[model samples]
Target: MVRIKQRYILFDILSPPSSEHWEAYSESRDSALLHLHQVSSSEISAKYLLQVIRQVLQDHYGDFGAGSAGISLVVKYFSPKTSTGIIRCGRQHLDMIVAVLALINRLGDKEVIMRCIHVSGTIKKCENVSIKRDKEDIIRMQRKRK
Candidate 1:
């Protein structure tokens, strides 16, 4: 039997500074994302994120070159609150995935940063850690709001 190993990469996204009245403008997660990223839509679905990542990979490596890299990537989760998400990919493609992630400085017209925070062999571990970190981020945001 042939076994395939997969790795889950967790990352946080940082966006440009919002206007002073950002609170008033951000009615929903999508709204906030749209405002922050200056994109036509606020929905950062797994499919959408994957498309963007693939585009980056393609840009760095031409279509055929990217295919030769043998990267099997998927987005597991994405949260606008913490700006954190998870990606699952073949173990062998981790380095290439990281490189592409590092090169992603812009999403649409907005300036952003995609910072990888962790990597794990299992999705459960990634989810647990992401939940913990997300809670901490929420707490920090609350403190800042006060």
Candidate 2:
């Protein structure tokens, strides 16, 4: 029996206008959290992300190459607070998925950038790393408040 291996790619979502948008959050923690939630709410959901990935793959590889790649993009976890998400796909198509991720320049006219920060074979490892990063971010933010 062949064990089907999976890969998880953790990524950060950034918009071109982030600097201007983030400036408003600098004033207060409440406002920051509120703005974070608002931005998170505005992002592309897992379903739409998958569609975009497929479209990108199609555009890059053409119909036959895309189909032959056997890509299946899945969102395992996404957190707006951290502006991070985890994607799951077969090990074989990891390159294809990464390529599509890099190729994505916009999401619904938002002019966004998706940067893959980490890739792992297990979901638990990815979750742990994401948690650690979230904690560090919180610590950094708290320090800046002082």
Candidate 3:
């Protein structure tokens, strides 16, 4: 029997502007899609990836408004062998990011094994890292013993 391990990765755009804000919105969308494609092609399964992406979008922006608002470009990827999944949010909303991460953490205690999650965004002057890690390096470091 082939031992299979499931991994879930969540990528959020974190405040994608409406289409009216085209210049900034388009750039943000492109950057996010590129990053997700790069990450997903590595080893993630496309089917599962799509599932997560759909769920996140529905959860954040209601299914009714996604199509009309031009936020319907979310991408997903899956690996054929192991079925590893990656979900990339088309337009990132900061509040949505917070909600998604919180949900992931809650679910992490359950069945899903969150192998790797990446969130990219510009930091505002007043925010702090709740899941402390070196911002310069994407590799998350656990808290060191004092």
Candidate 4:
């Protein structure tokens, strides 16, 4: 008997702020506030996101990398309202997937950035972290607006 270990990656995607917003955020020194694009949400769908990731994996790592990394790949959750998602992959290709995710710069016609927030061995932990982070993000964004 063999235990097939898996890793759950919690990630978020953001669309670059419109050019007007970028000019404004860039001038402010509060780099602490990374709103360079405080995009409230986006139009990304799970199907689109999964497709982008898979394609990028193939492009950057080639067929072999894509085949191995995608063998167990699954997009577990995606919320367009939250612009967040979770993906599960085999432990062996954790770094490969992360790298491929980072390489994804655009999805559909929108320029988007995919960021890995939390990685854990269990889906529960990833979900918990994402919820907590979402709350914090809302609070932070509200404060920035005030």
Candidate 5:
């Protein structure tokens, strides 16, 4: 049996800077502190994300685009606080998948921008890029405070 090559794309989910700046941090951490799960967590989950992508795929490229790109598409990780996530897709459909991601202008009711970071053959590299970007965001946030 041959293996199917895959690519992991790191993307940032950016929404308009909310009037409530600490909302993301509090929403993510408050639940953790209670050791309880929020019934409808404010976090943008992978499942919902996949559904949106599939819907958009169908809208833009019809069933063919959705089927071809949805083969192995998945949101690997999503941190609402930082608004960052990773998605895995088949290598053969990288272009179409990325286009779908770029085409995504909103998630739910909120208007958002999806920015593609580094696309890598390995999830580890994609993860590294995710961590590095998070760190930069933290630093930038800190500077604003001081």
Candidate 6:
């Protein structure tokens, strides 16, 4: 007989946005929150979470791909209200939590930080950024190659 083990990774972030803030952004925030539960372990899924973190970091720090420095920013700004003991898990899951927490700290927004901790899935790539360029920009650069 063969045995297969299922691995579970769970995290939670507690950022208590005020009623006023929630009311103002409730629709969009709720939509994003709903999507979090749908996240899964796939390249595309990891990429999407990365995209969200990148946007949050850029909005707060005005840059992306900041590496460890960025991680420091996240940890410094996002205060940890509480953290469950690190259960024995894969390094990937632990790394994801670290990266997410770092970003939350950088934002210095407790509400957002809390929400991020609860984000679904493990952040696979902590340092990769998705490059979004229009077709014209791509062609212009390709033409410049010659």
- Per-model tally of clashing residue pairs: 0, 0, 14, 0, 0, 15
Query: Looking at model 5, which ten-residue stretch has the lowest summed lDDT?
Result: 31-40
Q: Estimate TM-scores for all models.
A: 0.74, 0.79, 0.30, 0.84, 0.77, 0.24
| lDDT for model 1 | 0.76
Best by TM-score: 4
Q: Report model 4's TM-score to 2 decimal places.
A: 0.84
Error of 4 at 130 (Å): 0.6
lDDT of 6 by residue, 21-70 (tens): 56544656444343322322223223333345556545654544334223
Residue 69 displacement (Å), model 2: 3.9
lDDT of 2 by residue, 77-137 (tens): 7766556789998888898888888999977866767888789998888888888977876
Q: What is the Cα-based lDDT of residue 23 in candidate 4?
A: 71
Tell me the RMSD of model 6 versus the true structure. Answer: 16.5
lDDT of 4 by residue, 51-111 (tens): 8789989988899998989889999998876678899999999999999889988776777
Checking candidate 2 for backbone clashes, the offending pairs are none
lDDT by candidate, in order shown: 0.76, 0.76, 0.36, 0.82, 0.76, 0.35
Off by over 4 Å in 4: 27-43, 142-146
Q: Write the per-residue lDDT of candidate 3 for residues 66-144, one digit (tens) a residue.
A: 4432242333443333223333443434345335444442121222323334443322211233133224223322222
- As a whole number from 0 to 100, the lDDT of residue 77 in candidate 6 is 21
Model 6 quality (TM-score): 0.24
Candidate 6 residue-wise lDDT at 107:
27
Candidates in descending TM-score order: 4, 2, 5, 1, 3, 6
For candidate 6, which ten residues in a row score worst on lDDT?
125-134
